[model samples]
Target chain A: MPSLIWFNEDSLNPEHQMVKDYADAPKVYVFDAPYLQAQNIAKHRIQFIYEALLEIPSIQIYKGETVAVLLQLIKDLAISEVVTTETPNHMIKGWQNELQKSIDLVTYPEIFPVTDHSSPRRFSRYWRKHERSWLTV
Target chain B: MMQQLRTDLELADREAIATYLQSEFPFVEDSGELSPHVGGRTAGLVRLQSFRLEKYGKQRNFLDGEVSQLSPYVSRGCLELEELRQWALKQSRSKSVEAFVSELAWRAFFHLVYEEEGDRILKDMEKPKVPMNQHQRSLPEDIAAGTTGIPSMDTLIHMLKETGYLHNHARMYLASYVVHFRKVSWRAGADWMYSLLIDGDFASNHLSWQWVASTFSTKPYIFNRENLERYAGSLLPGDPKQGDPFNYSYEELAERLFEGAYMPEPSGRSPGQYQ
Candidate 1:
């Protein structure tokens, strides 16, 4: 069964490392109507995403409820699995849970370096601890 | 089984994208073309390559600073902060790059705060170090109109409305003016700025406003005419045709804006510490 790679805003680049990892899979990006409506994201931002989408070749764009779109695509294409890059978003986590119920879903770890310490509320404290580890030449 | 709900959704060009967005989200007014700053991965790469890290550190605060106008791309995830950092380090290995790198770190820091604290970043991170003058939750119509009677701020507001961009120093000044001087809540000011900015990120924009409002800092950030002249004087041509509201010293500004709601630090802590 074929698999689909869903691209979130954080992982939009066609050259994203995760996209290379899923080279043979068909790619899809949903406008995520619920999230857009809930966030009331600015028009300029949507324009930016629209421009970015135009750059990617052979990718599908969907505009509707995220889980519903995924389910429809899965059934229509006989997709056995779904994959996407991991994000810190709680909403995405919720979507991932629903998507996992019907199909094999895999989320790659975030592309950036991870700190051993938990993220701190104060930037000064977080910087004091993590800068030495991450900011080296 | 796959129904083609919208294969026609492929936006052919910039014009098509604008039309689709306008029709789909009729509530949001069209802001016209974004600044010459291009979008997409290719453009992002070009921007990263063109940035001069050494100059950026020395001049980023000025109105015409040698800043890397990459925030829009970075915030949109067209370019990653780590990628930019690596590129900067590769180009030049010097402490000069620290300022530019720290700005990127601030972006990452804001994201971390948002991820961990979630919506709570929208509120005060800590109780105000100085008592706030309890103002309205909504932004004042005059400020939104860009007719605040302060020449520098009005000019900045006009530029923000016309071009979806503002200098970092200008942003802090405006944020300070709105939250502290005008006595508007930071949430109101943050919402207004986020809506207008092309580089708008919920984490960075709101959190920075909180920083200015003294909610996320040890003291509220305020600026007066002399500070503005040092950074933006060249850009702000002509005299204050209107009454110059911001033409005051630090003590006078603090006294007038805060109206006894603020107290001066005892002993060694000078008034300059507020800025």
Candidate 2:
């Protein structure tokens, strides 16, 4: 039941905890075709992601339906857990929901310390709440 | 089954990446030269290293300013917000750094809202502060094709498709023209802009358009010719025509666009104002 690290666009950092904890895990990055078509992502954005994937030499890159591909990999490789970063994308959330039914998922917390309830209605208030804490540190 | 992209990350360079992309995704526009901005952590760090923390605050609002141009990296998660903050601190604690930090905070704020609102962020979150339901539900040919007659806006649109980068103020100006002047739905303009930007985050791009449209904020953002002249300086031909649509003052433009709607008194010391 070896684990696999799934790197999404928002979670490309190889230095992140997931990459560290799953040091020997088989890592994968996907260019989700349906998601790209649905979002109408163009060449410039895709090239940037491709360049980023080039940075992490260990991850296997693919172009396909992301959830189906990851699930297939999980089944083929006997992966018991799928680890990834918590991205706020609703589509990614849907993928997580689908993937979770089949295997345990370890999601890294959002890069920034924020929760739905904690967010202020206005940026000014949000800044006021977080300013000193940010400045002091 | 996933088609594993045939690329050896260590052996491949930009050309190799471009080749693979061309083969795998033929439908996407192959903007021949690919992106001018290089990706990877090294490029992101170099950008961070060269960032002018001081000029950022005073000049960030201009078309040609010391903006970090880091959004592309940040959006891809190649750069972290904390790293940016810490780097800015080492530069200085002046108002410029604070201003730069505030800008960064703006993106996170959008994400916070995005998390809360989910896909609803794509829709109008609140009643638009003005009457705009009649605006075009879809983009028009001229605007979509970037032949909108307004030179500044058309130039911005060309720059958007070509470079996948635009000054934030240019974006506001474009959004205002699309949302208010053309009377198109903010959603339409937002989706178009979001799709093209290299730094496009659905939350930041969409929410900013919503802010400009007065759907997410208290008032709609608009700019006049004189204001555009000050900031857009030299980016356009200095010879602005008298009959140009944006040549009017804020008061005149507001009356022209939102006539009969309740609007505050017109006033501005700059290129644009939110009323």
lDDT of 1 by residue, B100-121 (tens): 6677777777777777776777
- lDDT per residue for candidate 2 within B79-114, as digits (tens), equals 887777777767757989888777777887888898
Give the C-alpha miss distance for residue A88 in model 2, angstroms.
Answer: 1.2
Native-referenced TM-scores of chain A, all candidate models: 0.88, 0.93
Error of 2 at A28 (Å): 0.9
TM-score of each: 0.86, 0.94
TM-score of chain A of 2: 0.93
Question: For each candidate, what's the DockQ?
Answer: 0.43, 0.62
Least accurate 10 contiguous residues by lDDT in model 2 chain B = B266-275
Clash pairs (backbone) in predicted model 2: B227-B271
- Candidate 1 TM-score to native: 0.86
